[model samples]
Target: MGVPFEDFKFNRQILNAIADAGYTEATPIQQKAIPPILNGQDVMGIAQTGTGKTAAYVLPLIMKLKYAQGENPRALIVSPTRELAMQIEENIKTFAKYTDLRVVVLYGGLGPKTQIEQVNRGVDIIVTTPGRFMDIYLAGHIVTKTLQVLVLDEADKMMDMGFMPQINRILEVVPVKRQNLLFSATMSDKVHSLSANFLEFPTVIEVTPQATPAQTVNQHLYFVPNVKTKINLLKKLLDAEDDVKKLIIFCKTRTSAEDVYKFLLRKYGENGVKVLHANKGQNTRINSINAFKADEVKILVATDVAARGIDVSDVSHVINFDVPVVIEDYVHRIGRTGRAYQSGEAITFCTPAEEYYLDKIQKLIKQTIPVSDIPADVFVEATGFDERQEQAREIDLQKRKENPDFKGAFHEKKTLTQRKKFDAAKAKKTGQQTDKRNKSPKAYRKKR
Candidate 1:
């Protein structure tokens, strides 16, 4: 608690809202980004999720747009996903409770009628996803000329989701001289390119290294042999650990998430388990997230889409049921816990096939995840032949990626032998033909 929010000298309305939200001290990002944002400078912020980064820029934007102005929105915030867009809207509403600021959230999957109505009623702030924002804008429902500030939260995710074209289109339509704020967990090359094109001589603030997890999370890794063993280990942990009051299990795909959800449901019943993924309906996904946040569900299984936006502060554990292929997602997945300076645990299950991704994640985060043995009571299942072969192939692929000359177990010896024989035969035939051609015409006739 270095500096209290009151020290920032925000207006009375903003201060009151902050107090109502139970926020006193500023986080590191807020401390570094607030001043520059208040001064109306373009800012590029690199910080992990759950780092109070939303308020870092949001608070200042609120302070700058102190009062409701013209009919059109004066500030615009673009997020990568619908969940994150809603979360940002919620944050703005929390901090703007004492003011007359009107915020409208826009995203796809839901009809645009209500969103259009909200915008038509007149808004001061528009928090939206790139696609829906463009949709409503192109439909002539949104006014961008009056937009004073533009914020791109989760900039890296936006790049990953291929929203660059929409973002570039939006940038072209909006006022070029307005304040620009970009926040991302990692500063990848794509993110840097976006920042260079969007922000102008921006104040760059980095609270931590790129792709690093929060320090408050105690991380551990378990090397499981196969999927069945991974499930067995999950059940064993849930049954044995008394401290897992609230947990989010992250999977790599929707199908895997659904499988884990069904497993947990059968064991813990529907009341205790809920699943969230793109396959679920929008309302169901929202309900599942809400239930988990309210502590009504002991376990929530989800994919990486929920990793960045879930703001539950007391999540006791984050279990990576599948090692994320996208290495940066590992940071976001573990970030769901250990939020708001609270201590939490992150446990990851890595199968042999996923070891390659695990290695990349470890290198990206710049830390070796502590490996722990399976509990003695848990039954360790034997790896089947198919799974063993798959693991071997994956290992060989990883090695060959490191050294292209290295031959893998899957490399066909028969093909190599056949190639050698064919090459020798071809060389011998070519040599004989060359000898015949080299012989003089008279020598050839004498031999005949």
Candidate 2:
């Protein structure tokens, strides 16, 4: 049998909170990372999403903090995205419900006045994105000297979003002697470098291989020819009677997300669908997420920004409307489902152009996604000229990337055309010079 929470020896308050949250057994990450964290050691946890890594650290921190302290925050958790920061704050609130510890969340894309006021009122724990945290720090509204614990959640994502400079600044400003915790799904070189700079003799805990998807997620891929065909396939899948209570369709760009959202909206009406992307306002994004979480919307079409930190449990299906260009994001995207040991499905639609990215994603995850034929009910449309050209160009680019000396068909044709023009121009110039030199005496005299 799995180890129970009681074996961890948490205080009564924490144990009660855990029970209230409906958790009895500890996940592997929680069982392993909690002890070292509670022991006041710096920790570097390498685990993918849906592994209860958040609680692994949050529980220990709550147990250590116990109750309210001075006006300044004693612990700070920096997340890569606003959604993630908010999610962490919510988790902290749930686990710290019995205690008097005050928690505040800070992120960008909204007014800072309210956040600044919350900080002014004093908080025990601050969960924020690196940029917003730095903004408040620079504004002199925060006191980092009193910080006892610093956690960088999703450290790899922070590096990917180009927040390393802000992270470095925050690290420099915070007290040098403090308990530091770094967590990430993948251990890229940048994450490694950041860990070396931030963590001091950390107890490295890796519960699973880097970039690996959750075992509960059954992954499938479809080789679609074009966008319309993909849409047709999506329609067929959604129309089926399988368990699709909650679904998230991930698109690579806002335009694609909007397109998918429109299609779904027309079919299912606004009540059944919502869209989220960077183009949407902060309130709209938050509302979309809230609606999805509350089960008011059956489908959410989103970009990669929503892939990393969304924590809606029992997400029945995750569909890749567009293959993520960033291969590492594949793990996080599918992680939205199959949470808390529940079985879920992840379906990817791969156009010819997207196959390159798919290959990279498969390599990163260290497993081949099982390929399946398009459903017989789905109508496969003919590929359009523009789409075909785009796929060809993408394939050519991939070839060039692999072999620098390789010249694609388009490039070779263009080069041949340019050479013909150059040869014609040179021949014309040479003929003109010869004509001038071989001019008749009368013509030459007349010219002189």
Candidate 3:
């Protein structure tokens, strides 16, 4: 029955809470991880975004903490991003609804006083980002010695942002003998080494291969010319396709995310688009995310910072308006859709200069995306390839000249040896033309 809740040996209250949350079946990762976590064993879970990994740790931790019963927070969950941390805190509250357990989320970009007050209230569970958590802990506002369970959510992303040292500091303060659970969408050597340092004799659960997009996701790659052309192409694709019910447009930076959001808003009206990023205040970010989730907004443009821990299902399509700089990020960006076993589409617009990054993405995924050609009518004719190549070469030469360390060996005025080589090639071509002209008269006489 899809990994029954009863099989995990949860208390009746926890079982009732799960049923109340409208979840009877455990997800794949949850089915595998909940058992070990309930048994008080450390876990190393490898699963993609939107795979219910939150529940994999949250449910067990709730049951264990509730049963053991303490006022001070014994469980600590650290996420790489604020959105994810809030989502985890919300999920913990949802699962532990019937219990007296208190859950609070700690993140940056918000006032710390409220978070400090929550900690003072003696929360049983704490979900937070490492940076904000460390800030509070080091400021002597919160205590960590009571922490019994430690969770590093999105561990790979933590490493990506250079938060490993902060994570190490937090780990050092937590109670030495505790259950450690590390979860990441994709595991690398650095992530492995970090896991080695934290989790001891842990259970490893990898439902999907590392960095692999879901099979249900249809991926498309379009080779476009530039940013303006990409916008036009996206407009065309959106207008041409009838089934694009809801969309999440991912941008590479906050500026680009806002730009795309404004563009879409202007074209499609204010109701059509919303933007989410780190720069926004907590209330604003949460409101934007909720609006997108409730279908109040048809298109939500977001930076990679807000991409994780956004668990909205039925997202019909995800458009990479800008190709992600990190290949693994492409996996996470497109992963926003095609979740909950539903078919979804992910399209990436790759400029010529960005093709190298796209190629690396293909190599990592081990499957070449079918290149989509522009429709003949929509194709805007530009300069010839040779002319464009020549222009690019001239631009490179100009840049090198501007550099202080320009080497004379390459771009210096024609040296004697270089001139000799050029003249020799020109002379050979002239002699061939002369011979052809001579043979033309002979051939004409023979024809007569």
Candidate 4:
């Protein structure tokens, strides 16, 4: 109601494309951020993931390019991860399907020669991770001097991954006078300070509270004893619940993700589970995502890198296999489910070490999660418990050795349940020996 479709110079083709994509009303961030973006004004948008921030910028970029002539990279967008960069590219292609704007994605894990070929052929838009962008830019493969627009998506994550130094270097290479757009799910002090350096009197747009998790997700927290106990608890939940359609289990690192994925497969079956992480090749990651979306796989285990920009709805559950260190990451991981007004559940396994992280996440989401208690009947053998836990740890360690970039160092927090069972067995044996030694002569005669 605020702005008619005719008000913006959006071609009929783009309008039809948007309608085809099942989008009618613009989301709050889209409505507010799009106008200034079309006007070539710098914009600082504070919005969480899944709020259509991608469209907020993509539509305007395509509109601007409709009039601009040469395709020597007029728009440059920098994302923190390969998946996110690919997602931005996908959104641009979807929105600009009818337009003539050429979009290309550049990220690590793949060779740069292919990206260089795309750039040489002339691209209107380039979506890339900061490292890859800088790599090619410094080599003079990309002509940043002619860049008309620059966007930094997921700015906070970029800073978190230590991309600021590279970003500064990229900024120095690109032309200073250009339309700048900065978008982040949360506005940390570093993000605010980074915005100060780029945006010039920009229009600020915020649809959701900073670092706030979605309301549609029903969150549940379980206080478990340790890593092994958490695995057992998860197995119980999986076996007991009949309604679980699909799961995206999030670990803090690629190592933990793979380990959890392997454990689920070994415990459940190979047909039901798959793992996605940065260590996986581009084709494998993409194929795994597609398989999960198609319901070919019931469980998709992944790290925080998979949290952003992997959009698949109808996900019945999101399991925090390990509590994320970053509070915003908790929001992002849970966001994989409960999308498009559909209700979903998010379950987190928190050990004593992760309790503080859960507290921070609760504050970030502005609500206390209802605690879920594990039913008391499940049991593990006393003496075999340590051997089982030790074996699991060994497998996880071996996985880390194979993939060095795994990010979940704290997932290895030792739990008390394993130790408690050992202590109880030892105490019972001691008591039995003492009773035998203290038997009276009358008791011995009665036994005879």
Indicate which candidate wins on TM-score: 2
- lDDT per residue for candidate 4 within 291-343, as digits (tens), equals 88888988999988889888786898999989998878998899888876678
User: On TM-score, who's better, 1 or 3?
Assistant: 1
Clashing pairs in 1: none
Candidate 4 regions off by >4 Å? 1-8, 267-270, 380-448
- In order, the Cα lDDT scores of the candidates are 0.90, 0.92, 0.84, 0.82
lDDT by residue for model 2 over 150-236, one digit each (tens)?
A: 999999998889998999899899998899999999999999999999999999999999998999999999999999999999999
Indicate the TM-score of model 2: 0.92
List model 1 lDDT by residue over 18-41, tens digit each: 998988899999999999999889
Please rank every candidate by lDDT, starting with the best: 2, 1, 3, 4
TM-score of 3: 0.85
User: For candidate 1, what is the TM-score?
Assistant: 0.90
TM-score of every candidate: 0.90, 0.92, 0.85, 0.82
Which residue runs does candidate 2 get wrong by more than 4 Å?
416-448
Go through the candidates in order and give the C-alpha RMSD of each one to the true structure: 6.8, 4.2, 11.0, 10.9
Clashes of each: 0, 0, 0, 0
Clashes of 2: 0
Better of 1 and 4 by lDDT: 1
